[model samples]
Target chain A: MSAKIRLYVEHPLGAGQSVPLDRDQAHYLFGVMRQTVGAQLLLFNGEDGEWRAEVAEASKRSGVLICQEQTRPLVLPPDLWLLFAPIKKVRTDFIVEKAAEMGAARILPVQTEFTNSDRIRQDRLQAHAVEAAEQCGGTYVPEVADLQKLSRLLDHWPEERQLMFCDEAEVGSALALASETAAQAPWAIVIGPEGGFSEAERKRLHALPQSHVVSLGPRILRADTAAVAALTVWQQRYGDWG
Target chain B: MSAKIRLYVEHPLGAGQSVPLDRDQAHYLFGVMRQTVGAQLLLFNGEDGEWRAEVAEASKRSGVLICQEQTRPLVLPPDLWLLFAPIKKVRTDFIVEKAAEMGAARILPVQTEFTNSDRIRQDRLQAHAVEAAEQCGGTYVPEVADLQKLSRLLDHWPEERQLMFCDEAEVGSALALASETAAQAPWAIVIGPEGGFSEAERKRLHALPQSHVVSLGPRILRADTAAVAALTVWQQRYGDWG
Candidate 1:
C-alpha cells in the first residue's frame, strides 16, 4: 500500500491532541482505508507543516487522530500561477492535476467568449487539486479559484506578475520570449479555449504591459496540449529548472 | 476551412496528373466532406511531397483528383520513436494523439509485466494517429508498430538509438540529464506501465549501455503525465523548440 498521508485544515497539531476529522476525511480514512484505532497516519496542515498521527478512536462514520510529532516543515511554493480556460470535463480535470503536479502556486479558470463549458464545478475542481497535491507529496495545496470572466481577470491583473500568453497566432518561436521574460519574475501561463482567444481578447492581451505572446510551435495544439506545452516551456524558461 | 489534405500510399505525385481515389477515399472526400467535382484539395505522398489537387470526377464510391502543383517538399521527420506500455483504451488513444502532435517518427507499444491492457486494437490507434497528424498539418505520419513484448524489444534493441528511460524512482532534478543527453544521439522515450517497471525490468534497463535513467521531478506522476513531461523536457533540450 502507498503511504497513509492525510491532510486536515484544522488547528495546530500537537502531541497527544485529539482532532476529529471531518465527515469526508473520516470516510476516506476509516471507511475507505479500513483503519481502526491505533493505526498510524501522516497529517499535514497548510500552516504548521506535516505531522505523524495515530488513530485515537475509530467509528463507521467518524475517526479521531492524535497528533504526535512533525514529519516535515511547511515550505512555500514557487510564485507561479496557472490561468486556463476550462475545456471539457476530463480535460479540465487533467489541467488541474498537471498544474498542481507541476507546482503551480494558484489555479484560476477563466471564461472566454470561445470557451465551451459554461458549468464548471469549482468545488469538484478544488477537490482534484487537493487530491493531486496529496498524491504528489506536497504539503502546500494550490488555491483553486472560481470561474471568472476573462475581461474581469484582465482588469484585476497584477502588475508585477508577468503573463506568458501562449498565442497560436504568433509566427515566431516561443523560446526567445520565454528566456527574455523568465528572469526572476512572478509569472503565470495563460492558455486559451479550444477555439482560442477571441480577436478582441487577443488584442487586449497584446496591449498588456506584462503580457508576452509566445508561440508553442509551428503546429496548432489542442487547448489541453497547449496548457501542458506552455507549462513545460515556462518551467524550462523561468521556473526551478536550474 | 482548414486545409483539406488527403494521404495516399500510391506512386509518386506529379503536376497535372489525374489520379483515381479508391472507394474509401471517395467516401471520405465526397460522401463525408460532400465535395463535388472541381473541388480543390491537397494530396501528399511520402516520397513526392505535398501537392494541390482538384477534383476531376466524382461518383458515389469513386473519385478522381488531378494534381495541380507542389505546395511543399516532403521533409523527413526526426528519427525519434516513442515506446510506451499500453494503458486503458482512452489513454492509449491519447498517447497516440500526443505522440503524433509532438512529432514522433514512430510509436511502439510494448507489453510489460504489469501492463493492464494486453489487447490493443492497432487499427483504432492508427486511425487516431492519422487524425492527429492530419489535424496538426503534418505531412509525415508516425507509424504505430504492433504490440511486442518488452523483452523482445530489448533483445533487438538498436545500439545507435539512445533510450531516455524516464525513471520515476530517481528523485533529483531532470534538467541536467535532458541537456547532457539531448545532443548525444537519436533518442526515444520509454514510459513504463501504470504500476511502473518491475525490479528485474528496472535492472535490465539500468544495465543498458545507451540508456539514461532520468527523473522528472519530486512528484509522483501518472504514466501519461510522465510521458508528456519527459517529451517536453527532451523537446526543450534538443527538439525544434523554435
Candidate 2:
C-alpha cells in the first residue's frame, strides 16, 4: 500500500551508502513509477533482511537509494519444496508466483515425457518468484532449481525428504494421504504436466520409498490447477495449518 | 478419447426413436467436431444418465442421433455449494468451470459492496458450467443460481446449511471449525471478491449462527486461489475425504 517497493538481492545494505539499482529496476522505479530524490523506498537482501531507504539521487538512466535502518530480520524458510512440470508461459509464471507466496522452500521444474515446454527461462521465472515474495511480505525467497529430467530427479532424490506425488489416477482422496504424510520430516509436492505423467513415470514414482501418490479429486484438473490444488491440500494437512 | 464423443442432455434414449439435437449442439457435434452420420456419440439426462448413441443424420445446421444403449446410471452430486463473488470474465469462467468439475451441487454468485462486475451474464456462466460438467464426465450439471446481493442471500439463508467463510484475517491455522456445525447439514464455501468483504459484512457474517470464519493461511491469496483452496480444505474436512 505504500510507495512501490522493489527488492534486489545484490550486496548487503549499510548506513549512508548509495547502491545503484539494476537498469530494469531503475526504469521501473524511476521511469514507470516516477520516484524522485528524497522519496522513501524499501529494500531487502535475503541475508540482511528488510530495510527502509530513501532515494539519495535520481537520474534518467539510473537511481540510488541510501539505506536508513533495518525494518525486519532475516528468517529461515521452511523445508517445503514444489516440483512441477512446465506448462504454458503465463501459467508457469503464475505457478512460480503462487509457489513463492505459498512459502515453498524450493521450486523445481521437472521435465517429464509429456512436458510441453523444455525451454524455460530460469532467470525470468526467478524474478517472478522474487516479486511474489516481495508482494506477499515474505522475508525468505524460495530457490528455483534448474530444469531436470524426471528420471534424473528420482535418481538423485534425497532419501530423507518425502515426496507427495499428486497422482490423478489414485482412487482414494488426497486428504488421507496428506494427513498421513504430513508427520514426515521434509516434504515436497510433485505435479505432472498437461498431458499428465506417462505410465512408466507413474510406476517409478509408485516404486519409490519416499513417494506417496495422492488424488486431488474425482475431476480431471489442468496442470496449473493441480499445482495450486496440491499445494493447498498439503498446506492444510501439514506445514503451518496451526 | 474415442472420436471426440459429443455429449448432450436430452430426452430419454430408446432403441429406434431418433432424437433431434438442438441447433447449438448440432453445430458443435457436426460443424465444430466434424462428425458424420455414422459417428459415435454420448448423451445423458439427469434421470436415466449417460448413453451411447450414433449420428443418424448430419446436416450443416442441425443433426439427429439415435440412442443405442445406456452406459452409466445417473449419479447424484454431493451436497456442496460454491458461493463466490463474480470477478473478471476469464476468472469468473474459470471458477464456474472448476466448481462444476469439483462436483459442486450448486454455484451461487454473491454481490458484495466491493464486487466490481455487477453485469454477470448468468446464461454464459451457466453454459460454461455445462461445458465443464460435460468435459469432466459428470452426469449431473451443477445449477448456477442467479446473482443475489450478499444481504439478500443471507436474509433467506437456509438455517441448516453451514457456511464456511474463507476469512483471510483469521490469525490461527485453517481447520474445520467444529464437527457439530460441519456435520449437521449441507455446506457452502463463501469466497470474497478481489477487494474482500467490507468490515460490516464481515461482522454480519461472523454473527450468523451457521457461519464459521476459517483462515486459509498466513499468506493472502487472490479470490480465485482462495476459492480453490477453501473448497479443497472443505472437501478434505467434511466432504468425501474417504
The estimated TM-scores of all candidates read 0.85, 0.89
Q: Per-residue lDDT for B67-163 in model 1, tens only? A: 8898878755668889999998877888888887777889999999888777789999988887886676667778899999998999989877888
The per-residue C-alpha lDDT of model 1 at residue B78 equals 68
lDDT of 2 by residue, B1-242 (tens): 25347475657766665778888888888888888988887777656677788888889878788888777777766699999999988788888887877778899998999998777899999988888877777777888999989899899999889988887778564564577746758988899887778999999998999887788777667776777777777776677644
For model 2, the local distance difference test gives: 0.79
lDDT of 2 at A212: 71
Candidate 1, A1-242: lDDT as tens digits: 22455665556776777788888888888888888788888777667777888888887777788888888787656799898999889999989988887778899999999987666899999889888877766777888999989899889998888888888888455555544444577988899887779999999999998887787765667776777777777776677543
Candidate 1 wrong stretches, greater than 4 Å? A1-17, A177-182, B1-72, B175-184
Highest TM-score: which candidate?
2
Docking quality band of candidate 1, CAPRI definitions? medium
How accurate locally, in lDDT, is each candidate?
0.79, 0.79
